[model samples]
Target: MARKPKLAVWKFSSCDGCQLSLLDCEDELLALAGNIEIANFLEASREVIKGPYDLSLVEGSITTPHDLKRIQEVRKISKFLVTIGACATAGGIQALRNFQSVSDFISIVYATPEYISTLEQSTAISSHVKVDFELHGCPINKEQLVEVISAFLFHRKPNIPAHSVCMECKLAGNVCILVSNGVACLGPVTHAGCGALCPSYNRGCFGCYGAKENTNTSSLSNKLYQLGVKNQDIQKLFRSYNAYTPAFLKESKAHD
Candidate 1:
């Protein structure tokens, strides 16, 4: 029989939510296990199988010197590397510190700043290594995660959408909160994945899935300003879950 493709899941400096998304795949995971060799997943199993893994699903951003070295090693051993969630793909919520002084925060938050050895900024995996694919979301949509793994297994592109959350809102028949209630929303430029969850309930999107392809954040920001959203509030809006992503980061900086 042919050897099952070796799969590995790695964590750097994230909440481990993305890894849990895989385990949450309960039924599909059981079927996946039958076909793939889960080589190294500390959260799922303590059994450390050796690599050169065929595919690696990586979570979290590079936040320390150790993270920098470890990711290079992981890349060297894995034939295909896919970054999962906001942390791994766009530096996550922690990337908010990229705008401020890390040393000052460390001195205030840590009793001993000298003991804390970290990089100046939290950065995505792609910032340090060649990433084959990037699955964006705060925790990631479990269905999308499965599709990404399956795509790799089958040697095809993942069928994830590059459309904006506004498309999802329209498809789900959710009323436009921005137009009707003059609410400040990021849905116009944010990626579609969470099924427009917030807007479906009459709330605005927080952009947990990062920016969509060719996002016109400038136009969206102008619209928010017209809706009475203050410049500072607009800045904070873009600097939430996927702040460090280029599209959102540039827009956030413009408002600053």
Candidate 2:
């Protein structure tokens, strides 16, 4: 009998929401296990086997020197590496510290700054090592996760889109919250994945998934200002889960 392909999951610095999304795929989990050997997923099982793994799904950002070194080792041992969620793809909410002094942050939270050992900035997995694919979102959409894994298993391209969230809203038949009510929305430039969630809830987009391909962030920012969104709020909007994403970061700096 042939051995099943080994699958591993790795973590760095994140809220673990993306990892939870895998578990949330309760019905699919058993089906996936039958197709691949589950190995080295600390979040799901205590049983860790030695690698080189067939595939690796990585969650979170690199915030410490140790994590930087560790991810390199993970990359060497994994045949295919996929980054999942905002932290792994765009440096997450913790990346807000990228704009502030790490020393000041540690001093404010810790009794002794000397006791802490951390990198100056939080950064995405791709900043440290090569990534085969990236799934964008704060928590991530579970169905998309399944699609990515299945596509890799079948040797096909994942159907994830690089289009704007506005396209998703249009497909869902959602009213244009921005045009209709003057809401400040990132839907014009945010990547499609979250299914236009905020607009459905009567709130503006927050860009939890980073910028879309060729995003016109400056144009969107100007429009947002015209919609009466305060400069500070606009900065805050870009400073959410994906603040360090180059497009969002550059636009936020332009506003400031």
Candidate 3:
């Protein structure tokens, strides 16, 4: 029998939601386990197999000096490295600190600020290493996560969409919340995922999936301004889960 392809999952500074998304794939995970050797997933199993892993799924942002060094080693050992979720791809909600003073925040939050050792800014994995692929989302869509892993296993491109949430809203036959309700939605510029869940229920999109490819965030922000959305509110919307992503970060700064 052929040796099973080794798989490893790593975490840095995150809520561990993305790792849980894999475990949530209860049935598909069982089938996947049959084909791959889950070499090092601390959340799933404490029994760690040694690396030079065939594929590695990395979660979270690089927020510390230790994380910066460790990710370089992870890249050296993994043949293919895929970053998952907003944290891995765009630095996540923690990236909000990038706009402010880290030292001031640390002094306020920590009992002993001197004891905490961290980078001034939270940054994505790709900012530090060569990422083979990026799966974007706050927690990620499980179906998409499975497709990404399977694509690497089969040596093919993952079939994830690059469209905005507006496409999903149209496909689902939901009314345009921005147009009809005069709501401030990030759907026009945000990536497609979460099945347009918020808009389906008459709520505006929160942009948890990050900015879509070739997003026109300025156009969308202008539309929000036209709809009577306050400038500060517009800035806050763009500075959410995927705040540190280039397109969203730039747009948020425009509002500032």
Candidate 4:
């Protein structure tokens, strides 16, 4: 008999929203349970079996020395390692710490700053280990999460788009907010996945997903400046969610 493949999920410095996206699968998770042994998922099950896991879904950034060591161990055990969400793929909102001193941040946030143990920068898992795939988002879209896992289960590439959110906005028959309403938006450079949700509601994209491939943040920043968006706001715009992603980071610094 062919034994079921074992699945493991790990978390580091993150909000755990991406892991919740797995639970949010609700129905798909039930069907998925039939095919694989969910060996280690603290959020879904506390009974952690030892691993040389077949597949591992790792969420969050490496924010501390402990996480750095832990992820290396994870890479050793998992045959296939897939990093999920902006935290794991590009570093989440916490990546803001990368721009400034961790000591300064800790002093402001903690009354007993001496007790806070952390690294100076927040970084993606791929920065530390060889990742097979990366699924990007602030809190990753559940459909995309399913697609990633299903692809792994079938030993095939996931059919996830590499296009910008602007493509999704056009597909939804929504007018370009930047063109129609004179709003500053990241849709032109942000990745497609959330189905252009914010733009559909007549709001600008906040780049919940990371930068799309071939993103032109310089051009987008110029457009925003033309729209009378403040340089500070423009900086803030790129410094949120997927802040540390190479494209966004470079553009954000250019504004400084």
Candidate 5:
């Protein structure tokens, strides 16, 4: 029989939650194992295998000098490289360092700042090498991960949408919590795929899916202000998980 396609999973500067989502796919994982060879995933199994991998899934951001070099090597070995989660695709929460001084942050967090060696800012994998696809979210949605992987394996296009969460809320028949309950939401500007999770629980969107394609965050911020969200609160909202993304950052700065 011909050898199965090899798959590799890699991590950089991240919380590991996105990679954990893959493990969370308990039943689907076994089916995936049957279709591909687990070549080099450090988070799951201990068995090491050489690569020239068919597909590589990367999590986390490039935050160190070594990480920059390592990602270049990973790209060379990977036929198709997909970045999973906010960290790999949009520089994660750690990327807040992009706005402030790294040394100042290190001093605040650690007793010995000199002992720590970190880049001034954390950046996404695309900054280092070419990424074939990106799965968004703080920890990506499991179903989306399955679809991206399955598409690669079967040579089909992934069905991931680049629309805003407003579409999702409408599809789920969720009452507009922003209008009905007077809650400020990022739903209009945030990417869909969390299945309107927060709104389903009567909470506003936190932009976990990152910025939607062609976002109009300025309009959303204006609506939020009109809904009585204080300017400081508006700033705080955009400064959450996906703060560093260009659209969110620009809006947050305007409010600030």
Candidate 6:
């Protein structure tokens, strides 16, 4: 009999929403457990197994000196590492501080700034390690998470789309909020995973999944400006959830 592949999940500077997406899998996760060795997931179980692990799913960004060292060790132990959610793929909302002075931020957030030890910038897991694949979202869609894990178990590449959320909105039969009401939306540039959630409710996309492959944020920015979005607000929009992503970061810096 063949042994089940070992799986581990790790977290860093994040809200733990992405890890919860896994547990939220419920029955689907139970089905997955039948084929994989549930090795080291502290969120799901206290029992930990020794590595080198077959696959590791890393959540959150590297935001401290300790994070840098820990991720290196995780990289050394895992055969294949996948970064999940905005933090793991693009540094997350916390990356908002990458625009300002860390010292200033510490002084403002903590009474004793000297006691807090942290790096100046928050960054994605891929920035520090060779990532096999990235799953994007603030809190990732559970169906996509299952698909990624299933692909690994079966020895194949996951078929997650590289399309934009606009397509999803169209498919879901939601009236185009941008077209109908001149709303400022990141759907044209954001990666598709959330099923155009906000647009469904007449709200604009927040780019929770980060920039899509080959996105034209410049065009989107120009469009926003035409729709009467203020320049500073446009910059803020780009620098939201997946701000530290290269395309969005570069685009936002252009506004700055």
Q: For each candidate, what TM-score against the reference? A: 0.97, 0.98, 0.98, 0.97, 0.97, 0.97
lDDT for model 4, please: 0.93
**Model 6 TM-score?**
0.97
| lDDT of prediction 6 | 0.93
State the displacement of the C-alpha of residue 249, model 2, in Å, after optimal TM-score superposition. Answer: 0.5
Q: Model 6: which residue pairs collide? A: none
In model 3, which regions exceed 4 Å deviation?
A: none
Total residue pair clashes for candidate 5 = 0
The whole-model C-alpha lDDT of candidate 1 against the native structure comes to 0.94
- For candidate 4, lDDT tens digit of each residue in 1-256? 5888999999999999999999999989888898888999999888998999999999999999899899999999999999999999998899998888899888899999988889999999999999999998888999999998888888899988989999999999999989989988999999999999999999999999989999999999999999999999999999999999999999999988
Q: Which digits, one per residue and each the tens of the lDDT, describe model 2 over residues 20-104?
A: 9988999999998998888889998998999999989999999998998999999999999999999999999999998989998
Relative to the true structure, candidate 4 reaches a TM of 0.97
Better TM-score candidate (2, 5)? 2
> For candidate 6, lDDT tens digit of each residue in 120-199?
99999988989999999999999999999999999998989989999999999988888789999999999999999999
For residue 155, what is the lDDT in candidate 3?
A: 89
The lowest-lDDT stretch of 10 consecutive residues in candidate 3 is 219-228
Q: Write the per-residue lDDT of candidate 5 for residues 1-256, one digit (tens) a residue.
A: 7789999999999998998998999989999999999889888999979989999999999999889899999999999999999999988888887889998888899998888988998888998899999999988999999999999988999999999998999999999899899888899899998899999889999999899999998888888889988999998888867777788889888986
Where does candidate 1 clash, by residue pair?
Answer: none
In model 5, the runs with Cα more than 4 Å from the true position are none
Cα RMSD to native, each candidate? 1.0, 1.0, 0.9, 1.0, 1.1, 1.0
**Model 5 lDDT at residue 119:** 95
Candidate 5 residue pairs in backbone clash = none
